[model samples]
Target: MNNIRNWLMGILAGLATVFLTVGGVRYVMAGGEPGEVEKAKQAFKSAGIGYGLAALAPLVVTILRGIVGV
Candidate 1:
């Protein structure tokens, strides 16, 4: 279970990193276009959410485990 938990956390962190990197690249490549900038901003927002979820995953999992008596 510990191994599985670690694996999931790692995957979530990796995905968050990927989203953040892609969002940053998109922002940089927007070239001052308002629509593109908005899209890039949305991507950045998604990345932030991903990061927040990833950061919270361990705590969430622990809480769940305790609730279920794992």
Candidate 2:
């Protein structure tokens, strides 16, 4: 149970890291192009969502455990 939780946490953290890195690169390379800037903003939003999910994973798992009696 704990192993699974730890694995999920790691995956979510990795997703956030990847999105953040991509967003940063895009932003730097956008060079004031509005379209590119919008895309970069989307990547940043995705990164934020991933981070939020990672932060909530433990709490969510605990809730599931309670409901499922795991």
Candidate 3:
């Protein structure tokens, strides 16, 4: 059961990573005008930062949970 749960979590994480990466790339590609491109570029940068924060969130949560014995 634990292994199955782990597998599901891993799959979800992988999919999230793929979705964010592809979405960022697609936004950059679909930038139509100069202003739109700039907006997309900024969004891509923010998404990258968000991705980093999201990657940290689980680790942090796990650590806290372990510490709290939750």
Backbone N/Cα/C clashes per model = 0, 0, 0
**Model 2 C-alpha lDDT versus the unseen true structure:** 0.91
Question: lDDT of all predictions, in order shown?
Answer: 0.81, 0.91, 0.62
**Roughly what TM-score does model 1 have, to 2 decimal places?**
0.81
lDDT of 1 by residue, 1-70 (tens): 5676777778877887887888788889989989888888887788788778778878878887899898
Q: Clashing pairs in model 3?
A: none
Per-candidate RMSD, Å: 1.5, 0.9, 4.7
- Estimate TM-scores for all models: 0.81, 0.93, 0.45
Point out the higher-scoring one by lDDT: 1 or 3. Answer: 1
lDDT (Cα, 0-100) at 10 in candidate 3:
63
Which one is best on lDDT? 2
Q: For candidate 2, lDDT tens digit of each residue in 1-70?
A: 6787788889998999999999999999999999999999999999999989988889888998999998
Best by TM-score: 2
lDDT, residue 18, candidate 2: 97
